[model samples]
Target chain A: MDFLTILNNSAAEILSPSTAAFALATIGLNVHFGYSGLLNFGQAAFMAVGAYAFAIFTMQVDPTATLGWPMWLSFVVAVLVAIVAAVAFALVLGIPTLRLRGDYLAIVTIAAAEIIRFTVRTSDYSAVTGGSQGLRGQDYKGDITGLNPLTGTTYGFGPWTGTAYDTWIRILAWTLVVVALILVWLLMRSPWGRVIKGIREDEDAVRSLGKNVYSYKMQALVLGGVLGGLAGIMYVLPRAVQPDNFATAMTFYIWTALLLGGAATVFGPLLGSILFWVLLAFTGGMLSGLQQIGAFGDMSGTQAGQLRFVLVGVALMLLVIFRPQGILGNKKELSFHV
Target chain B: MSETTTDGTAPTATHPLVDGEVAPGCKKVDPIVVADGVIRQFGGLTAVDVEHVEIPRGAITALIGPNGAGKTTFFNLLTGFDRPNKGSWSFEGQSLAHVPSHKVARRGMVRTFQLTKSLGRLTVLQNMLLGARDQRGESFFAALVRPLWRAQEQSNTEKADSLLARFKLDTKREDYAASLSGGQRKLLEMARALMSDPTLVMLDEPMAGVNPALTQSLLDHVKGLKDDGMTVLFVEHDMHMVRHISDWVIVMAEGRIVAEGPPETIMQNQAVVDAYLGAHHDTDLGTLTNQQVAQIHEAAEEEVPVGLEASATETTTTDAPAEPGATAHDEEGKR
Candidate 1:
């Protein structure tokens, strides 16, 4: 591919429906770990719920034949399932662990996410879920492709041009990101958001004021999880419903995005996600170009991919040690001694 | 007429005229809180174990005790900040024994911390806004409709600003709460408690660590709570503050109320005296009495020339008007 072609492909991936899903998920994580100081490590569970619920529902719409259910219905079902799963997960994890210190909750949530992933991976109902191999060839493009004005024709506005599917997913994904961002921004500015921050500072003081600190925390967790679920649905839209796709690494990536942008601010997650993807793409592209010219010195392509993670890890560690507040996070907010 | 009763138990009931003062206003009146057989034990220690206690409505009552006396624990229980091993109390006529702390605040009862608990990162105004938490502009749906939530948030902010002004903190309203002086923080905490429009306000050591220059303001602000028809319950170690302002005083020692009465009567009571200054001292309830605490405070005030007169006023109350220091020591020896 030419340099332009390479850049265009990278841009396409960054602006894809999948990227939108990750962005939204990271935003929700911002609410959890960023704003409220919750240590949720299983954000992917929320995604799994949304994606699996939508995919399973869509599949069930036709056991013998396609029920031809509208894609909008699937989206709505996905969101609702995500919300319910989030609330349930929050109650289960929150009740026993929220009252404990922060580290314990972090462990529980991470373990819980793993358990959820493994459970889905090993379940006997392999036919509906596609077992360990996972579901494949999902026709998510049917509705968007058909409705596109350029469904059967090439659409070009400038040097940039793409098929209807690519354009449609970008439009839908970005619209969701904007809406979720707005929602988070408004919610954080609300009185309820104040209580969550208060809970972060001092639960005793908040309680003394007659506010339910525990309940406020649970609500924040659920809200963030629901957003994560929306991201999950978006995550699997362009691809198949695969259990391995909802990996622990994905949650960690979301966290990386949140920290890179800012935790407390709504715009932090969006900016962080974009920066992360761009950096990853740049690193990958540089390594590949070097490999083609035998400029690796001794590094292999696989090693380069792993090296990208190592670089990201080092960046995160430095961020935590030197600037735990993240790029946009307030230093004062980071000092929650409680 | 009789110093000793027929049973020879030092008549436990009459000499102090102020004993009956807290009773008249409370006769046949409905109590806002009634704690019966409440007990809190930690390891081998009992933090609070009151058999019976009642908090009158629309009045400022002080819960006084020395260190380790469970005053904080009782405040915690009443506000649902902690769960007592055993105790049941009510707010208004409602049984608040099982109700959560936030629900307690929602039911028009709000409290401040003994140590100020302001969110440091947020501005003083933002902290104050957090206090007006029950305002109906927080729902997700309401948030989407900007006009409604925006108006409500504006009104809340305006109200918080007015409260800040009343507390003489208008100049620092935009500053971070952590940047505030100790006295200003005390003031901010009090002002924030009022943001919820609570009917009952509980202040835990509101005057602790406050400057003498601001003590009177804190006292007056507390008094103003009662004037505004809000019930005030506070935990304080300052007997003079309790005497000067409290309508009723409940003395706690080792987690139980040893005496309950008006300030004047409670101060002179043998039991109240024994709770303080220990059991071996003579009846020299003079400067060594409430005045000693004020005197310790006065010593701290000598550095500020501006508050010299206020400190003198505090001293003059402990001594004869003509000879402040001489009479103060003399009074300390004479009870």
Candidate 2:
């Protein structure tokens, strides 16, 4: 029932690596749904691929994995593997479906992401994926923490404080977010962005103009999926590569983050992710605190936890109803349709 | 009738467009696009089934057909947007069969859609710039480096600015295209197509949904294409537009080229008049009284198909599409 602790924890989420990871995923989704108008409903699948690939490479899942590689080599190769796998997945999903329409891609992507989650969680792959148990955070933590150049044990001021290792991950994650922001901004500002946006509004128009709508859509899918893979890598850096964490709901959370901020803007994802995490933490903390103080009557801790999602549903409806273009979207230009 | 409806801006011979006798699938003196055995089907419906058609070079040719004669489908096939069942088309003598739409555009043939596809979210300038071909910045990796595409982008922007001004859309350059009226959207779509600098520009019903006030300017813009030494092919329902600007006219009915000749000849051809245009084409549908409509309907009852009656009725009264509506209204008045 400690309000101070709840407030402090909620504030701490603003700079957390998880928030950064969510921002990264939202940024990638922005590239897909916001700019290219590709409705990718399976962003969680990309995160799964990146997380599992990076972890499996680091853990040396079996003897057949890249043998005798150093930790840094494993990490780098793991990232590359994530990127390649994401691109491959994008191609698999895009080649047949991108030509169909936005909804078809959404359907295929959601199915593909769910398949990835189920396959990884199945007992058949328990030897490598750890099944429902998931790999321990300690196993992957060593590689990244060992590479941390910062010597001091504790870092940052006030409630923003973290261990040297945590600070290192946060720094790296935020750096990626910044780099992704710049990349999106640069691309969107260029003539390439003009074509991508054109495809978003009308692919046929872009096609008639001779810009290869299919190719542009594929590129956008691959580009966004690669970023999603990178986000996955960063997401699991501090946590276990849990299969359950990358459920369909994970993809939706990323979408919520994207829409909450503004899908097509440069810093909208970052701002949204931070705000989402902060508000989520605040709401969850407040609900749990209220439950503990008997405000919920006989409601259990789990039921109290479920109430925050109801709030999310309400928030999403309000967002769509009031500001479909989102916080940073231009009211005149970027209104949501479908 | 004049041999060429082309205005006094420049002098060009009219009959120089056709090579042989005026007929369906006739040869052009210099054909920019030649299609052989182009066929497209959707279930039982053969949308486009052209045997042999040649688009004349450096001239404005109008493709005129009734509603379902597959004019847009033919345009789609030629532009490589949609594939034909078993035909080959060459744009500027380069075989464009199975080529992707963008490549078809790169090979110097570009098109516009029947329904204006102006990128509503983009500014007018952005929509125009997207039409330019072979930009270094359009590539994904090269776009990251501003220096690689900045000069080209600048020049493309300038080109786009000029086109917008020419289309009288310069004032709306900074505005989102969604804010534009229906006519402006059509103009923007055409201007955007011109950005590619194509040798052959195919405009699919460029006048559809356009305001009549802007139609003349749009007509001038299409003429301007021929003036710039580019071949202009357009699909339009307006016969006046076809007769006023087109050097040649290719008539399609039931997915086949029914006739091809100078605009003057196509207008005179008996089969062309019967298949489309109709015998009463000179009589304004709107001006016809109910008695006049009934008289025309009774006289042409055996010749005109039920489809043409619906279309004729559709033209006369926008809301009441059938004689049943007129009869029902008469019953209401009697009651």
Candidate 3:
């Protein structure tokens, strides 16, 4: 029942790799749904591809489980494979569907995500993807942590304490987030970005202006998908590459973070992700404390966990009702009709 | 009436559609767009069926017809916005049968929407910038490196600024297009279309929903295109605007060219009047005042052909000619 411990845990969660992963994913979602008016409901699929590609590439090439490639080569190859997988996904989904408008992309993307999850979780792909048991991060965690520049054995004071390895992961995750933000900002300010925004507003008008709307849409899909892939790679660095981690609910969480921050704004996703994690941590900690003190009568830890989601849902509904444009989104730019 | 080409470029034999003897579907002296056997059908209905038609170069031409007469559909077909089932059209001697809309626009034929698609979310200036052709900044990789397209962007911005000034929308350049009034939206759309510097500018109902205050400016803009050596093809229901600015007029009725003439002769043509008034033209006279009714009857008596009234009465049960508001029905019927 120590309140200081709870406060410390929440603070630590704010800087955790999980927040970074969601932030990165949300930024990609911003490109697809916010700026381009593309409905990509399978962002989780891109993350799964990235995580599995990295895991399968780095794992030992044994009959029981992996390729066992050199750590450095596997890391680079994993990123490339993730990018290829994302582009392939975009082409397969976008080719027949970009020409048609509304809800089709949502349906296809969600179905694709579910398909990826089910395929990887099956027994057939167990050798490469580790099936439901999942790929152990302990095998390659050292490959990444070994590159840490920090000299200290344990970093940070009391409440924010973390080993140098943990610090390295946080630094790498934040670095990726910064790079993504810069890239997104630069693109949005450019003429290409202008056209993307125009497509979101009225694609026919853009087409009439001599632009290839289909090509632009494909580009957006690939770019956003690649970011989702990167997020997936970052996500598995501090945890096991479980097929369950990249679930449908992961996409919903990313979307919540995106909407909370402001869909189209550059800083919206980053801030939204941080806020989302911090709030979740704070509420969970508070609920656990209350349950320990018998304030909830007979409510167990599982019920408390369920209630945390209910509170977040209520908060999201209130935000949407009060500000449909999101925290930083312009009301004029929110043409959901498109 | 004396046969005169509005642009006064050259005098050819007078066609029957005009004061001259050029019949329907006849060639023009200096045609910019030539369509031969262009047909667009939606299900069983034929939306556009132009056997042969030529839009005169360097002059303002009007495409007028009753509601659902396929004026807009023809525009769509010619501009590559919509495909024709069976037809070939060429702009400036180049075949544009299967060309995409953007490519057609790049080849100096650009169009504006009838409903005024102003990209409500984008600022006025952004809308204008979207019109400029061959934009280097439009490339994905090039956009990342600003220096590659910065100069061109500056030039585009300058051009947009001047056009915005001309359209008197400079003050609202940063404002979202949705904030503009309906009339202002039309003006912004026209200004945006000019960014391409197209040789052929096709306007679809440019005056629809426009305020009276802006109508004169819009007319002047239409006339200015011709003065600048550009071909102007417009679809409009405002007869006065048609007669005032158009050098030549092509009239469509039931997806066919019923008449092609100068504005003066078009108003007097029996087919043109019948297309406007419909088959029950005389029966609806009760809605008119005494003087108006007298004028209509007098005109009908002078213009209605022998035994034409009997035939008109026989077909009263058929669908009436489309009115301005009936355009949606016409499009649906075509499908």
Candidate 4:
């Protein structure tokens, strides 16, 4: 077995740009479910809107199919459009569902995410969205790669080496994560943050104090959604824009990362995302090596691939059963009304 | 005391309802809160059904009744915590029928929950800070920029600190509310209510789970509210407390007002006595054995004298019932 390669791959996954993207998304989840006690299961929908909006704005396509905007302007426009789309999505979902408590929001949000995924996959909008095949990396990779200051350099030693373009994306993604963390830290310490925490504990108590509970919840939803949109943009930076990437499972994975670290804590998502990806990569490598060596009598390569997720599921269940507060969350802070 | 005012306004006469009076719908001379046809129901059960009731302005009014008498429900409806089936109530002069609980508090009428709704996860100081009115820091944009609300926050903290000292909870300022004792939580709730500077403070069972040591202090703090020219309306089951501090008493039974009078007379009223002992009224004395009869007599003798003394002292004194009560009234009158 190539144990050395496995270790290197796992290390790379931990520091990869995708890990940064997931960390940012989970941070937004922390704001929604952790601090505010809002049950938002459609984080994937926000990410999808952000990714698609950014891709569409920046892509050079037929005049009828796309905007064909300038690359730099498109980058700014894409981010703005993604945030606005997320807010619009929050309004459409939040206005009606925020009034209802708990499971209603969960059901509506999960359903909304599925709807977004399916809508993008349909042939009806294939002209702009590229349908099921989705827009490939070639569409906007040149523009994104062109912005990298390090034109022809390679970083890191041995197996850890990354192209200048990859390095640029990683820097940008991690920088976004840092910015999101600082903003969230400032927010949670403020009076507004206290109100959100109060709502999570007991909304009625907050209402009795003359603070508008609904308005606070809506603000939390929009803030979290905007962050999710940014995460979506970060996610697409290193790869192609695929509708499948924004599926319901993507949200669950983000939730898993959030819960794995610590739901309400600032550092929880960052650590959780890194650990999750690293574990997945390490397990995948070990399992594939074992299968190639005929470790299993009848289990095929595909079965081994599926078994890796099963192991992850088991790990998640154990985590919930024993340490429900997650790695960094305080047991006291986790006593939410939901 | 019964002399009518010549100013063409409602009479400010004391004890409008005579001793042992059973008024179906009592009206105050200058009512601070007026309710008409207020009814609340939970499925088939009618929780509160007040046809007409007026709470006297600037007086300590006690709403007393047996269990399930709907005292808390009435408080809920008046404070806009719960909606009434069909009713309208006004605070000061504005109608509060459709006003929300937060707006009711903003309009100078605040209430505490019977179960004590202190934000448990928050610090005592933070809880007190939350009670401050119209905080700029509470806004979304203002919260991000501390300078916008830093001065207001400092002032609010000062106010909260003073209130905490007044409530004797200054030592536990940084402690989480959940870590506090039951009685301390009650104190925290009352102290928090004062941060609003409310005109009318409605306390729901402020002494429900409190120890005797804290109960006396809570009683004094409530009396202090009246001394500061704030109208105090409280829901209480402790007859001794109701008799000791209440200027006027309104008693409810089976979701309707059965008696209204000064504290001294409310105990002697037939409607109230029946409301309390009505379940045993139909019991046959002949059916009970001699031992059981003696036990019943012993129980009555022990309880009846305290009630009698409470009523007697309350009715005879035109100034105030107890020494503390007298001083409280004087202080209020001075204010």
Candidate 5:
């Protein structure tokens, strides 16, 4: 492809429905790990909940296969299911571990996520989940596209501009992001947010203030999880619902995005997601070009791709060690002493 | 053998005549919190073992003792941070024996920490807002509808701001709590505790790391809690501050109350003296045992002028005459 084509494709990838989904997912992660300080490694479970719920309802459960229920209703139901699933997970994990120190909660959550993944992939549930082959025909593009409010044809002056579908998803995804960010901002500004932060800092002190530390923590967990699940539902909107799609890598990517932007800030996750994808695209494209030019004797394309993660990992480690507070995260936010 | 028999029979014979058969008790008053046979053990060590203790209503009560005296543990038990091994306590007549920490706060009882717990990353105002956890729209559905909770949230912010202003933290409202000085953080914590609109406020070492300049202000703020009809109970080591602000005092040593009385009377009690000042003062309880303690009590009663030296110092200067410890203050201050 030409330079302009390469750049345009890269831009499309960065602004695609998939990117939007990941961005939303990262935003949810921001709520859990960044804002509430919950080390939830099962964020992908929420995404799976959303994807599977939406897929199952439309594909198998609903009376109609092709012309299913209203997309909005389906979206709502899927989100609700994801939230319930998240809350259930949180209760199971939080009940036993919230009383203990922080690391136990992290371990339990990660394990719960693993269990959830394995359960969904089992032979018994394969009929519904499609197991390794995974469920397909979850594309809501045509149905959702019909509902679009756009009245005019797409206008593009140059190669940089994209088609109607790209614009639609971009607008919708960003809209969701903006609304979510605003709600988070407002909640953080409120008295309730202060109590949550207090719990984060010193739960015992907050408890002494006649505040219910556990209740607040539970609320934080549920709220963040629900948001994460919502992001999950949004994630599968344009893609096929598959088990591997909601793998552990998704969680790590979201964490990377969140850290890159700034964990606790309002715009941090959004910016981080955009920057993360942009950098990944540029690196992959450059590495491919180098390989095509025979920069190395026999460096495989897969090796080049994996190197991107290594670079990002090193950057993340360095960031955490030297400046744990990300680009937008406040240094003060990092006072949890260990 | 006859003399030993006389010694034992003498006390028994004198008990009825001297009216010392029954132990005296403080006049019964409304208790903010009452712990009955409370006991908490960690591993093999019993951290708190209180037979009975009552925090008087609408008064400042100081829970004082030396280090490892289980004061913090008692605070934890009372607030539901930890469960007692065998005990029952109540706040405002409600049994809080098994209530959780958050539920304790909802029951109109709140507490501060010995180590300040201001959310370092959060702004001071945000920290205050957390204090209003119960006052907001807690329902998930209710939270999404901004208008339903906005007015209430706005009002809460306004309330938090007013509290910040009252505590003279208005200027630091936008500043991160971690940026505050140790004293300011203490003020922020106290101010945040008030956000819950609690009826009883428990402070754990409110003056531990406070500067002398801000110490009196903190004391006055605690006193203000009682003036506003809220019960104030605090753990403090500063005896002067304790005696000045505390209407009632409960002295703890080794996880048990050794003495409980009015601050004035408590200072004179032999048990209180031994628990607080130590056995070193036992030498003064000689031929004039009662008289010297009475003299010390009378001297302590004459409050030294405000901004003047402490009564303990003035007494050492005026009464000790030729003792080496008489110059103890001057020597220490010079060093």
Candidate 6:
């Protein structure tokens, strides 16, 4: 309940693998909503596909499991499978919805994400998907941890300290985030980016210019979703792969992070994700410390735990009102649209 | 043939534009685009029902009509922006019916929107660059490696720069297209369309919101397209612009082609005079007498006004009314 301990806990969230995962996912959402003007409200579905495909496929390498694939082969195939699944999801979602107006995509994506959650949680596919309780992290984390190069009990210094496994996961998660950032940066400056941005402004105009607007949009959707899938894998790396984790609220949280950082900007997602988690952790720590000291007059830990999100909601509203274009977005470019 | 272009070239389509008698659905000496039975209906309203239309290659053909005449809808159908009830169209002799707008453009036919659809958030240069065809950098995988597309990007930038310079938009290249004036945006849109070196150009109301002086420059640019041997088809309410720049004019009324001919004779066409154009179609709005103005208003009360129905037909060098004596000089100078 010490204030120093509270501050330390909040700071630790900045470098947490969870922060990296959300950052990666928000970057994917940025590609969807920010650059392409696509409203993908089912980003969590893309993440879910990644997590499930990776966990299920990697689990196949277990000697007792079916197929009994080699560990190395399973590792490579799991990543590839995640990517392919994300693409298939994109094609399915985009073929019918991309031609429609922007709002339709938003509706379809949100519905699709929910459908994915429900379908996976249903008892019918419980053996493969692990049902509502979901697959345990220990089942599949072994491959990634097996591949980890770090060989120390503990790592890092001071407030950023973590076990070697934690350090390895952070490295893996951030490396993916950096790669995605670089890819997005390169794309936005190219003629491909110009065409995409033009579609954002007006598809008719881009179409008149002879660029395949639909193809470009599909490409963006798949690329962003693949990144989302990777983020999904990252999200569950340090914990369990619960079906409830990829619920509608997860998609909304990614959106909040994207808007907070700047939807169209290169570093906006990373910044937004860091700020969102750090603030959430900080507020949660403060509230619980107060609760332990009887500040809420016998407020239960569960009740205090939920209060931090209320503060986050308030912060998000304030952020939207004051800086809707986000920290890094150009006011002239995205202020009206964002 | 002696008509000097802005860049000192002669007009390419000087021999003859039509194969026979000038009429609705008339055969062109060389048509870049040919359409038949393009019927588009909006529930109770028939938007466009052009039975046959041919756009002359390497010449500026003006498509003019009053409000609700379906000129834009026909433009949409031909450019593959809208679907027709039943129609067959060919661009450069290849059938293009049901082709998407981008494919229609890829066939070397590009269009500009009547509302001037400039990508507002994009820089003026970026807007122009988006019009370039076969851009290697525009492919998703190719975009990642700068080396793969750097040479093409450089060449494209150069081409874009020259087009911007030609449109007099070079100064605003780095500025976002949204920040441009209405006239500048029109100019930018036209320049962007030219980036692909299209064989056919379709413009919808390029002069609707432009200033008159800019209209004059836009007139020169359209003329320049013919000099470069690119076919130009445009929708314009500005009778003056249509008469000055267009080599041929096609008039539409109530979703059908009413008449087609050179603009000099279009005014004298009996069918055009009755079905659509006002008697004072050629008269400058600034020069209209109070009685003539009242007649236009009176006509509006009865039905759609022949001349006054056009929005901003008088956008010119000055909003100040022209002196009575200047009208003759203005008409003569345009001729």
TM-score list, all predictions: 0.82, 0.88, 0.87, 0.84, 0.80, 0.88
After superposition of all CA atoms, the RMSD between model 1 and the true structure is 12.3
As for TM-score, the candidate ahead, 3 or 4, is 3
TM-scores computed on chain B for all candidates: 0.76, 0.79, 0.80, 0.79, 0.75, 0.78
lDDT of 4 by residue, A1-338 (tens): 89999999999987789999999999999999989888889998989988887777666442222555555555666578778888898888889988778678889999999999999999999988999988887676656665677877898666557889888989999999999999899888788888888888777777777778888999999999989989998999899999999988899899999999988899999999999999999999999888888997688988987888999899999999888989997776445432
DockQ list for all candidates: 0.32, 0.54, 0.47, 0.31, 0.27, 0.50
Candidate 1 segments whose C-alpha is farther than 4 A from its true place: A1-13, A63-79, A95-104, A139-149, A153-161, A291-296, A321-323, A330-338, B1-31, B277-335
lDDT of each: 0.76, 0.86, 0.85, 0.85, 0.73, 0.86
CA RMSD, predictions in order: 12.3, 7.4, 8.6, 13.2, 12.4, 10.7
Give lDDT tens digits, candidate 3, residues B192-252. 9999999999999999998898999989888887887888999999998998998788999
Best first by DockQ, ranked: 2, 6, 3, 1, 4, 5
- For candidate 2, what is the lDDT? 0.86
Q: Which lDDT tens digits does candidate 6 get at residues B32-92?
A: 8898998999998998989999988888899998899999999898888889999898988
lDDT of 6 by residue, A80-167 (tens): 9888998999999999988888898999999999999998899999888889989999989776787889998999977789988899
Poorest lDDT segment (10 consecutive residues) of candidate 1 chain B:
B1-10
Tell how far residue B9 is off in model 2, in angstroms: 30
For model 1, how does the per-residue alpha-carbon lDDT over A1-338 read when each residue is reduced to its tens digit?
Answer: 25665566566556656678889999999989877889899888888877777677656653223555565555555457656766777788889988777788799988888887787788687877777887774444344344445564444444335566656666777899999998887777777777777776667767766666777788888888888877887777767788988889988999998988888888889988877887777667766776666776787778766777877898889988898777787776555543
Q: Model 3: runs farther than 4 Å from truth?
A: A60-71, A140-142, A149-152, A331-338, B1-20, B279-335
Error of 4 at B146 (Å): 1.8
Q: After superposition, how far is residue B51 of candidate 4 from its true place, in Å?
A: 2.3
For candidate 5, lDDT tens digit of each residue in B1-335? Answer: 11112222132222111122111223335667878899999999988999877776878888888788888899889988789999898887889999877788888888888888877877787777777755545554455566777787788889998888888899998888888999999999998888888899889899989999998888888888888889888998898998899876777877888766556555665666677667786576446678888998888767555326666566767566466766776567679
Displacement of the residue A174 alpha carbon in candidate 5, Å: 4.2
- C-alpha-based local distance difference test score of model 4: 0.85
Model 6 superposed RMSD (Cα): 10.7
